[model samples]
Target: GAGVSQSPRYKVAKRGQDVALRCDPISGHVSLFWYQQALGQGPEFLTYFQNEAQLDKSGLPSDRFFAERPEGSVSTLKIQRTQQEDSAVYLCASSLDGPLREQFFGPGTRLTVL
Candidate 1:
């Protein structure tokens, strides 16, 4: 892809339901990241992948939040048993390497848990 792309710009999920958000990063990028952004707040890193290896997942709010980059390009973030607190914009970004380099971000998947 020419730029990062995320599916379902907005999602509405009832509490306790599971949802999966997709992301297609720029072609041949080596670093991918998932971030959670609450309304009126800055994005916070949720996880990072260097190629197919998940090197960091320190910022995931809880066990219900899971992310994966199986083929080093496309990735998915799944939230299980969603809670009201989970309502936020889930953003995905890709870079040539890591934070040391500039990254391009997708518009994001806004998840609203009710």
Candidate 2:
């Protein structure tokens, strides 16, 4: 089975540009999560999805951040207006549907907002 994957492993965007990041979770794993990690900080949870339903998005930093899982599978995270402060590694992880299970993470999409 395929593991999680992210596209354009690295990106450089000018300030105010919009960028979209993609994630594909392991087949049949029903829980998916998106996170952001600053240079020295641990990954911070951005949003969580159970199946196709977005259950929590409290961690989205601003209105510019959005995520979706339209088919109960592959997910996307979009940043509407990139800023220098938004430069960070965005990660996606998935696991068996529920809390407390160990999560398998993808190699993150590294975004540089210049």
Candidate 3:
């Protein structure tokens, strides 16, 4: 019963650079989601995937952001051409299968752009 995990815990990048963040969800889970949380703001849904199929990605701010859940488990979020406004905590969560199910979240990957 492994829990969700994120790497780097923190990332500092120069504006216009590309950054990739990783998330490892619990074993056997079928649903995953990525969210962005700005300082003093609520986490906003960025994308969702059921297994390797991406269900939604309308929340991604722009083409600069991309995500994928290959093999229906581990996921990665990549932000290209980073900007100061892009600095925030990127969170990943996983659930068993429905909206009613509880989603477990990792500590998050805090990104800082300079």
Candidate 3 TM-score, true structure as reference: 0.96
Q: What TM-score fits each model?
A: 0.97, 0.97, 0.96
lDDT by residue for model 3 (5-100), tens: 999899999999999999998888888989999989999999998989998999999999999987888899999999999999999999998435
Per-candidate RMSD, Å: 0.8, 0.7, 0.9
Model 1 is weakest, by summed lDDT over 10 consecutive residues, at 1-10
Candidate 3 lDDT score at position 50: 90
| Tens digit of per-residue lDDT, candidate 1, span 90-110 | 999999988779989999999
Candidate 2 C-alpha lDDT tens digits along 56-104: 9999999999999999889999999899999999999999885468898
Overall lDDT per candidate, in order of appearance: 0.94, 0.94, 0.92
State candidate 1's TM-score.
Answer: 0.97
Q: Give the better candidate number (2 or 3) by lDDT.
A: 2
Residue-pair clashes per prediction, in order, are 0, 0, 1
Give stretches of model 2 more than 4 Å off: none
Worst 10 residues of 3 by lDDT: 97-106
Off by over 4 Å in 3: none
